[model samples]
Target: MSQSATTTQNPRNPDRHQGLANGGTTFAGVLLAVTGLLSIFRGIMGIAKNDVFVATKDYVFRWDLTGWGWMHLILGLLVFLVGLALLKAAPAWARTAGVVLASLALIVNFLSLPWHPLWSLILVALYAFIIWALCTVKRGHT
Candidate 1:
Protein backbone atom coordinates (compact mmCIF):
# COMPACT_ATOMS: atom_id res chain seq x y z
CA MET A 1 0.00 0.00 0.00
CA SER A 2 3.12 2.22 0.04
CA GLN A 3 4.82 3.69 -3.09
CA SER A 4 8.23 2.45 -2.03
CA ALA A 5 6.90 -1.05 -1.33
CA THR A 6 6.15 -1.94 -4.97
CA THR A 7 8.74 0.28 -6.65
CA THR A 8 11.53 -1.54 -8.46
CA GLN A 9 13.93 1.36 -8.40
CA ASN A 10 17.49 0.50 -7.48
CA PRO A 11 18.66 2.24 -4.37
CA ARG A 12 21.96 3.24 -5.89
CA ASN A 13 20.55 4.80 -9.07
CA PRO A 14 17.01 5.97 -8.49
CA ASP A 15 16.79 8.22 -11.51
CA ARG A 16 15.55 5.28 -13.56
CA HIS A 17 14.22 1.85 -12.91
CA GLN A 18 16.62 0.31 -15.44
CA GLY A 19 18.51 1.18 -18.55
CA LEU A 20 16.60 -1.63 -20.20
CA ALA A 21 13.40 0.35 -19.67
CA ASN A 22 14.16 2.11 -22.97
CA GLY A 23 14.15 -1.30 -24.73
CA GLY A 24 17.24 -0.75 -26.89
CA THR A 25 19.70 -1.38 -24.09
CA THR A 26 17.81 -4.48 -23.06
CA PHE A 27 17.74 -5.77 -26.60
CA ALA A 28 21.42 -5.08 -26.97
CA GLY A 29 22.10 -6.95 -23.80
CA VAL A 30 20.15 -9.95 -25.01
CA LEU A 31 21.97 -9.94 -28.31
CA LEU A 32 25.31 -9.68 -26.58
CA ALA A 33 24.46 -12.62 -24.35
CA VAL A 34 23.39 -14.76 -27.29
CA THR A 35 26.48 -13.91 -29.32
CA GLY A 36 28.73 -14.47 -26.34
CA LEU A 37 27.25 -17.89 -25.69
CA LEU A 38 27.60 -18.81 -29.34
CA SER A 39 31.19 -17.70 -29.31
CA ILE A 40 31.83 -19.71 -26.18
CA PHE A 41 30.45 -22.82 -27.81
CA ARG A 42 32.53 -22.21 -30.91
CA GLY A 43 35.58 -21.69 -28.76
CA ILE A 44 35.00 -24.98 -27.01
CA MET A 45 34.71 -26.72 -30.34
CA GLY A 46 37.88 -25.14 -31.64
CA ILE A 47 39.84 -25.96 -28.50
CA ALA A 48 38.48 -29.46 -28.13
CA LYS A 49 38.79 -30.36 -31.80
CA ASN A 50 41.71 -28.79 -33.53
CA ASP A 51 40.51 -30.39 -36.71
CA VAL A 52 37.13 -28.75 -36.49
CA PHE A 53 38.34 -25.80 -38.55
CA VAL A 54 39.89 -26.19 -41.93
CA ALA A 55 43.39 -24.93 -42.28
CA THR A 56 43.69 -22.11 -44.74
CA LYS A 57 46.44 -21.48 -47.27
CA ASP A 58 47.89 -18.02 -48.04
CA TYR A 59 45.72 -16.47 -45.35
CA VAL A 60 47.25 -13.37 -43.84
CA PHE A 61 45.58 -14.01 -40.45
CA ARG A 62 46.61 -17.58 -40.13
CA TRP A 63 47.16 -18.80 -36.61
CA ASP A 64 46.65 -21.78 -34.33
CA LEU A 65 43.03 -22.74 -33.98
CA THR A 66 43.52 -23.45 -30.29
CA GLY A 67 44.81 -19.95 -29.80
CA TRP A 68 41.72 -18.53 -31.42
CA GLY A 69 39.69 -20.75 -29.13
CA TRP A 70 41.24 -19.24 -26.05
CA MET A 71 40.62 -15.76 -27.36
CA HIS A 72 36.99 -16.51 -28.04
CA LEU A 73 36.52 -18.13 -24.67
CA ILE A 74 37.88 -15.16 -22.77
CA LEU A 75 36.20 -12.50 -24.87
CA GLY A 76 32.89 -14.31 -24.88
CA LEU A 77 32.82 -14.51 -21.11
CA LEU A 78 33.49 -10.78 -20.81
CA VAL A 79 30.85 -9.86 -23.36
CA PHE A 80 28.29 -12.15 -21.77
CA LEU A 81 28.86 -10.73 -18.31
CA VAL A 82 28.67 -7.15 -19.55
CA GLY A 83 25.49 -7.90 -21.43
CA LEU A 84 23.92 -9.26 -18.28
CA ALA A 85 24.90 -6.08 -16.51
CA LEU A 86 23.22 -3.96 -19.15
CA LEU A 87 20.00 -5.91 -18.74
CA LYS A 88 19.78 -4.70 -15.17
CA ALA A 89 19.97 -1.17 -13.79
CA ALA A 90 23.54 -1.03 -14.96
CA PRO A 91 25.82 1.95 -14.52
CA ALA A 92 27.15 4.05 -17.39
CA TRP A 93 30.37 2.07 -17.36
CA ALA A 94 28.59 -1.03 -18.65
CA ARG A 95 27.48 0.79 -21.78
CA THR A 96 30.97 2.00 -22.49
CA ALA A 97 32.39 -1.46 -21.90
CA GLY A 98 29.73 -3.01 -24.09
CA VAL A 99 30.76 -0.83 -26.98
CA VAL A 100 34.41 -1.70 -26.44
CA LEU A 101 33.72 -5.38 -26.10
CA ALA A 102 31.46 -5.48 -29.12
CA SER A 103 34.09 -3.72 -31.17
CA LEU A 104 36.62 -6.31 -30.07
CA ALA A 105 34.10 -9.02 -30.84
CA LEU A 106 33.78 -7.68 -34.35
CA ILE A 107 37.53 -7.88 -34.82
CA VAL A 108 37.82 -11.36 -33.41
CA ASN A 109 34.91 -12.72 -35.40
CA PHE A 110 36.23 -11.06 -38.54
CA LEU A 111 39.69 -12.56 -38.10
CA SER A 112 38.33 -16.04 -37.51
CA LEU A 113 36.32 -15.92 -40.71
CA PRO A 114 38.76 -18.22 -42.49
CA TRP A 115 38.02 -20.95 -39.99
CA HIS A 116 34.22 -20.65 -39.76
CA PRO A 117 32.95 -18.42 -42.48
CA LEU A 118 29.22 -18.57 -41.83
CA TRP A 119 29.26 -18.36 -38.05
CA SER A 120 31.91 -15.67 -38.03
CA LEU A 121 29.92 -13.54 -40.43
CA ILE A 122 26.80 -14.06 -38.40
CA LEU A 123 28.60 -13.06 -35.24
CA VAL A 124 30.05 -10.03 -36.97
CA ALA A 125 26.55 -8.93 -37.86
CA LEU A 126 25.30 -9.46 -34.33
CA TYR A 127 28.21 -7.54 -32.85
CA ALA A 128 27.55 -4.69 -35.21
CA PHE A 129 23.99 -4.45 -34.01
CA ILE A 130 25.04 -4.65 -30.39
CA ILE A 131 27.39 -1.73 -30.93
CA TRP A 132 24.63 0.33 -32.45
CA ALA A 133 22.19 -0.38 -29.66
CA LEU A 134 24.64 0.37 -26.89
CA CYS A 135 25.77 3.57 -28.54
CA THR A 136 22.27 4.85 -29.18
CA VAL A 137 21.33 4.93 -25.51
CA LYS A 138 20.87 8.51 -24.33
CA ARG A 139 23.57 9.95 -22.11
CA GLY A 140 22.78 10.50 -18.42
CA HIS A 141 19.76 8.27 -18.93
CA THR A 142 21.45 4.87 -18.79
Candidate 2:
Protein backbone atom coordinates (compact mmCIF):
# COMPACT_ATOMS: atom_id res chain seq x y z
CA MET A 1 0.00 0.00 0.00
CA SER A 2 1.31 3.41 -0.96
CA GLN A 3 1.52 5.80 1.99
CA SER A 4 -0.02 9.26 1.62
CA ALA A 5 1.83 12.27 2.99
CA THR A 6 0.08 13.93 5.88
CA THR A 7 0.10 17.72 6.15
CA THR A 8 0.43 19.04 9.63
CA GLN A 9 -1.61 22.07 10.72
CA ASN A 10 0.13 24.98 12.36
CA PRO A 11 -0.62 24.67 16.03
CA ARG A 12 0.14 28.37 16.43
CA ASN A 13 -1.54 29.73 13.36
CA PRO A 14 -0.02 33.15 12.67
CA ASP A 15 -2.20 33.85 9.68
CA ARG A 16 -4.59 35.65 11.99
CA HIS A 17 -1.98 38.33 12.51
CA GLN A 18 -1.12 38.51 8.85
CA GLY A 19 -2.76 41.88 8.51
CA LEU A 20 -0.56 43.32 11.22
CA ALA A 21 2.44 41.26 10.21
CA ASN A 22 2.44 42.57 6.66
CA GLY A 23 1.87 46.23 7.62
CA GLY A 24 -1.70 45.88 6.45
CA THR A 25 -3.02 47.22 9.73
CA THR A 26 -0.70 50.21 9.66
CA PHE A 27 -1.71 51.18 6.15
CA ALA A 28 -5.35 50.70 7.03
CA GLY A 29 -4.97 52.76 10.17
CA VAL A 30 -3.33 55.65 8.35
CA LEU A 31 -5.92 55.54 5.60
CA LEU A 32 -8.75 55.53 8.11
CA ALA A 33 -7.32 58.50 9.96
CA VAL A 34 -6.97 60.43 6.73
CA THR A 35 -10.53 59.56 5.78
CA GLY A 36 -11.74 60.90 9.13
CA LEU A 37 -9.93 64.16 8.55
CA LEU A 38 -11.41 64.51 5.08
CA SER A 39 -14.90 63.86 6.38
CA ILE A 40 -14.46 66.53 9.02
CA PHE A 41 -13.33 68.98 6.36
CA ARG A 42 -16.34 68.20 4.16
CA GLY A 43 -18.67 68.55 7.12
CA ILE A 44 -17.22 71.95 7.92
CA MET A 45 -17.55 73.04 4.32
CA GLY A 46 -21.16 71.88 4.24
CA ILE A 47 -21.87 73.79 7.44
CA ALA A 48 -20.28 76.96 6.13
CA LYS A 49 -22.27 77.02 2.90
CA ASN A 50 -25.25 74.72 2.64
CA ASP A 51 -25.95 75.70 -0.93
CA VAL A 52 -22.52 74.59 -2.09
CA PHE A 53 -23.95 71.11 -2.36
CA VAL A 54 -26.66 71.64 -4.94
CA ALA A 55 -29.24 68.99 -5.69
CA THR A 56 -28.83 67.19 -8.99
CA LYS A 57 -32.51 66.34 -9.34
CA ASP A 58 -35.71 67.77 -7.90
CA TYR A 59 -37.12 64.41 -6.76
CA VAL A 60 -34.00 63.35 -4.83
CA PHE A 61 -34.19 63.28 -1.05
CA ARG A 62 -32.93 66.51 0.36
CA TRP A 63 -31.81 66.92 3.95
CA ASP A 64 -30.63 69.96 5.84
CA LEU A 65 -26.98 70.35 4.95
CA THR A 66 -26.29 71.47 8.50
CA GLY A 67 -27.76 68.20 9.76
CA TRP A 68 -25.39 66.25 7.55
CA GLY A 69 -22.56 68.35 8.89
CA TRP A 70 -23.28 67.31 12.43
CA MET A 71 -23.63 63.67 11.45
CA HIS A 72 -20.34 63.67 9.59
CA LEU A 73 -18.57 65.56 12.34
CA ILE A 74 -19.64 63.02 14.96
CA LEU A 75 -18.84 60.05 12.81
CA GLY A 76 -15.53 61.55 11.76
CA LEU A 77 -14.50 62.01 15.35
CA LEU A 78 -15.37 58.40 16.13
CA VAL A 79 -13.56 57.13 13.08
CA PHE A 80 -10.50 59.13 13.99
CA LEU A 81 -10.51 57.66 17.46
CA VAL A 82 -10.82 54.14 16.12
CA GLY A 83 -8.04 54.78 13.64
CA LEU A 84 -5.76 55.83 16.45
CA ALA A 85 -6.72 52.74 18.42
CA LEU A 86 -5.83 50.56 15.46
CA LEU A 87 -2.40 52.15 15.25
CA LYS A 88 -1.88 51.22 18.87
CA ALA A 89 -3.10 47.66 18.35
CA ALA A 90 -5.91 48.17 20.81
CA PRO A 91 -8.43 45.47 19.93
CA ALA A 92 -10.66 43.93 17.29
CA TRP A 93 -13.66 45.91 18.45
CA ALA A 94 -12.01 49.12 17.25
CA ARG A 95 -11.64 47.73 13.74
CA THR A 96 -15.20 46.42 13.82
CA ALA A 97 -16.50 49.84 14.88
CA GLY A 98 -14.47 51.45 12.10
CA VAL A 99 -16.11 49.18 9.55
CA VAL A 100 -19.61 50.00 10.79
CA LEU A 101 -18.90 53.73 10.83
CA ALA A 102 -17.32 53.58 7.39
CA SER A 103 -20.39 51.83 6.06
CA LEU A 104 -22.60 54.56 7.49
CA ALA A 105 -20.35 57.23 6.05
CA LEU A 106 -20.66 55.57 2.65
CA ILE A 107 -24.46 55.77 2.82
CA VAL A 108 -24.35 59.36 3.98
CA ASN A 109 -21.95 60.28 1.21
CA PHE A 110 -24.14 58.52 -1.36
CA LEU A 111 -27.17 60.54 -0.28
CA SER A 112 -25.09 63.67 -0.37
CA LEU A 113 -23.78 62.89 -3.86
CA PRO A 114 -25.76 65.69 -5.42
CA TRP A 115 -23.63 68.15 -3.49
CA HIS A 116 -20.25 67.07 -4.93
CA PRO A 117 -19.94 64.04 -7.09
CA LEU A 118 -16.15 63.87 -6.94
CA TRP A 119 -15.95 63.96 -3.17
CA SER A 120 -18.78 61.47 -2.90
CA LEU A 121 -16.89 59.08 -5.13
CA ILE A 122 -13.78 59.47 -3.00
CA LEU A 123 -15.74 58.68 0.14
CA VAL A 124 -17.23 55.61 -1.53
CA ALA A 125 -13.76 54.32 -2.39
CA LEU A 126 -12.51 54.92 1.13
CA TYR A 127 -15.56 53.10 2.45
CA ALA A 128 -14.72 50.11 0.29
CA PHE A 129 -11.12 50.07 1.58
CA ILE A 130 -12.27 50.24 5.19
CA ILE A 131 -14.76 47.42 4.69
CA TRP A 132 -12.17 45.27 2.96
CA ALA A 133 -9.56 45.88 5.63
CA LEU A 134 -11.97 44.97 8.39
CA CYS A 135 -13.58 41.96 6.72
CA THR A 136 -10.48 40.31 5.29
CA VAL A 137 -9.23 38.96 8.57
CA LYS A 138 -11.00 35.83 9.76
CA ARG A 139 -12.44 36.67 13.17
CA GLY A 140 -11.42 33.68 15.26
CA HIS A 141 -8.49 32.88 13.03
CA THR A 142 -7.05 36.25 13.82
Candidate 3:
Protein backbone atom coordinates (compact mmCIF):
# COMPACT_ATOMS: atom_id res chain seq x y z
CA MET A 1 0.00 0.00 0.00
CA SER A 2 1.12 3.53 -0.65
CA GLN A 3 2.29 5.60 2.35
CA SER A 4 -0.38 8.20 1.55
CA ALA A 5 -3.02 5.49 1.56
CA THR A 6 -1.88 4.25 4.94
CA THR A 7 -1.81 7.72 6.39
CA THR A 8 -5.28 8.53 5.10
CA GLN A 9 -6.74 5.23 6.31
CA ASN A 10 -5.45 5.73 9.83
CA PRO A 11 -7.86 8.68 10.40
CA ARG A 12 -5.68 9.89 13.27
CA ASN A 13 -4.47 13.23 12.12
CA PRO A 14 -2.45 15.55 14.33
CA ASP A 15 -5.59 17.53 15.19
CA ARG A 16 -7.46 14.47 16.40
CA HIS A 17 -4.45 13.23 18.36
CA GLN A 18 -3.98 16.62 19.91
CA GLY A 19 -7.64 16.77 20.87
CA LEU A 20 -7.34 13.43 22.63
CA ALA A 21 -4.28 14.60 24.50
CA ASN A 22 -5.93 17.87 25.40
CA GLY A 23 -8.70 16.08 27.22
CA GLY A 24 -6.26 14.62 29.71
CA THR A 25 -4.26 17.81 29.92
CA THR A 26 -7.36 19.84 30.62
CA PHE A 27 -8.37 17.53 33.43
CA ALA A 28 -4.91 17.64 34.91
CA GLY A 29 -4.86 21.41 34.74
CA VAL A 30 -8.13 21.69 36.60
CA LEU A 31 -6.97 19.27 39.25
CA LEU A 32 -3.69 21.09 39.67
CA ALA A 33 -5.39 24.44 40.02
CA VAL A 34 -7.78 23.13 42.65
CA THR A 35 -4.98 21.47 44.53
CA GLY A 36 -2.90 24.63 44.41
CA LEU A 37 -5.74 26.69 45.75
CA LEU A 38 -6.21 24.23 48.57
CA SER A 39 -2.55 24.43 49.39
CA ILE A 40 -2.73 28.19 49.47
CA PHE A 41 -5.59 28.03 51.93
CA ARG A 42 -3.71 25.57 54.07
CA GLY A 43 -0.70 27.85 53.99
CA ILE A 44 -2.76 30.83 55.04
CA MET A 45 -4.20 28.88 57.93
CA GLY A 46 -0.75 27.95 59.11
CA ILE A 47 0.72 31.40 58.64
CA ALA A 48 -2.14 32.99 60.45
CA LYS A 49 -1.42 30.69 63.36
CA ASN A 50 -4.96 29.40 63.12
CA ASP A 51 -5.84 26.49 65.40
CA VAL A 52 -6.95 24.41 62.45
CA PHE A 53 -3.88 22.18 62.37
CA VAL A 54 -2.23 20.21 65.16
CA ALA A 55 1.40 19.21 64.70
CA THR A 56 2.61 16.05 66.35
CA LYS A 57 5.37 16.58 68.84
CA ASP A 58 8.78 15.00 68.19
CA TYR A 59 7.85 14.10 64.60
CA VAL A 60 11.12 13.53 62.74
CA PHE A 61 10.13 15.84 59.88
CA ARG A 62 8.60 18.44 62.06
CA TRP A 63 8.93 22.04 60.89
CA ASP A 64 7.78 25.30 62.29
CA LEU A 65 4.18 25.82 61.31
CA THR A 66 4.94 29.23 59.89
CA GLY A 67 7.84 27.84 57.89
CA TRP A 68 5.71 25.16 56.35
CA GLY A 69 3.11 27.81 55.72
CA TRP A 70 5.55 29.88 53.69
CA MET A 71 6.67 26.85 51.75
CA HIS A 72 3.12 25.88 50.87
CA LEU A 73 2.21 29.41 49.94
CA ILE A 74 5.08 29.71 47.49
CA LEU A 75 4.78 26.22 46.09
CA GLY A 76 1.05 26.60 45.73
CA LEU A 77 1.48 29.78 43.73
CA LEU A 78 3.90 28.08 41.36
CA VAL A 79 1.60 25.10 40.95
CA PHE A 80 -1.33 27.37 40.31
CA LEU A 81 0.55 29.27 37.59
CA VAL A 82 1.70 26.08 35.89
CA GLY A 83 -1.83 24.70 36.01
CA LEU A 84 -3.14 27.81 34.36
CA ALA A 85 -0.49 27.57 31.67
CA LEU A 86 -1.41 23.98 30.97
CA LEU A 87 -5.05 24.88 30.68
CA LYS A 88 -4.27 27.58 28.14
CA ALA A 89 -1.59 25.66 26.26
CA ALA A 90 -0.37 22.11 26.87
CA PRO A 91 3.21 22.76 25.90
CA ALA A 92 5.91 20.23 26.70
CA TRP A 93 7.50 22.47 29.31
CA ALA A 94 4.17 22.96 31.03
CA ARG A 95 3.79 19.20 31.41
CA THR A 96 7.28 18.99 32.84
CA ALA A 97 6.54 21.77 35.28
CA GLY A 98 3.30 20.09 36.28
CA VAL A 99 5.03 16.85 37.07
CA VAL A 100 7.81 18.54 39.02
CA LEU A 101 5.43 20.71 41.05
CA ALA A 102 3.15 17.78 41.70
CA SER A 103 6.06 15.75 43.00
CA LEU A 104 7.07 18.56 45.32
CA ALA A 105 3.51 18.91 46.53
CA LEU A 106 3.42 15.19 47.27
CA ILE A 107 6.55 15.44 49.35
CA VAL A 108 5.26 18.42 51.25
CA ASN A 109 2.00 16.68 51.93
CA PHE A 110 3.82 13.61 53.15
CA LEU A 111 5.86 15.64 55.57
CA SER A 112 2.69 17.39 56.64
CA LEU A 113 1.01 14.14 57.59
CA PRO A 114 1.66 14.66 61.23
CA TRP A 115 -0.12 17.97 61.18
CA HIS A 116 -3.25 16.89 59.31
CA PRO A 117 -3.24 13.25 58.43
CA LEU A 118 -6.51 13.09 56.53
CA TRP A 119 -6.02 16.25 54.53
CA SER A 120 -2.42 15.42 53.80
CA LEU A 121 -3.37 12.00 52.50
CA ILE A 122 -6.03 13.47 50.31
CA LEU A 123 -3.57 15.96 48.84
CA VAL A 124 -1.05 13.18 48.39
CA ALA A 125 -3.56 11.18 46.39
CA LEU A 126 -4.42 14.21 44.30
CA TYR A 127 -0.76 14.97 43.61
CA ALA A 128 -0.20 11.37 42.57
CA PHE A 129 -3.07 11.60 40.13
CA ILE A 130 -1.70 14.84 38.71
CA ILE A 131 1.68 13.22 38.21
CA TRP A 132 0.12 10.23 36.50
CA ALA A 133 -1.95 12.35 34.20
CA LEU A 134 0.98 14.54 33.29
CA CYS A 135 3.33 11.62 32.73
CA THR A 136 0.94 9.36 30.87
CA VAL A 137 0.66 11.67 27.89
CA LYS A 138 2.85 10.24 25.16
CA ARG A 139 5.73 12.50 24.23
CA GLY A 140 5.43 14.11 20.76
CA HIS A 141 1.80 13.00 20.73
CA THR A 142 0.68 16.09 22.53
CA-only RMSD, every prediction: 7.7, 5.4, 4.7
Model 3 Cα lDDT, one tens digit per residue, 36-120: 8888988998899846778677899867899999999999999999999988875789999999999999999999898889888
lDDT of 3: 0.85
Q: Name the runs in model 1 displaced over 4 angstroms.
A: 1-21
Model 1 agreement with the true structure over 1-142: per-residue lDDT tens digits: 5767546454655435345445767888898888888878878988999998897897898788999988998899999999899888699899899999999999998998788898789889988888877777655675
lDDT of 3 at 4: 75
Q: Which candidate leads the pack in TM-score?
A: 1
Candidate 1 residue 90 Cα shift, in angstroms, is 0.7
Instruction: Please give the range of 10 consecutive residues that has the lowest summed lDDT in model 1.
Output: 13-22
Give lDDT: candidate 3, residue 106.
Answer: 97
Each prediction's TM-score versus the true structure: 0.82, 0.77, 0.81
Point out the worst 10-residue segment of candidate 3 by lDDT: 13-22
lDDT, candidate 2, 1-142, per-residue tens = 2222221234345553554543665667787788888878877877888776675667377678888888788878777888888788767887788788878888988887777788889889878877777766654633
- lDDT value, residue 68 of candidate 3: 93
Q: Candidate 1's error at 107, in angstroms?
A: 0.4
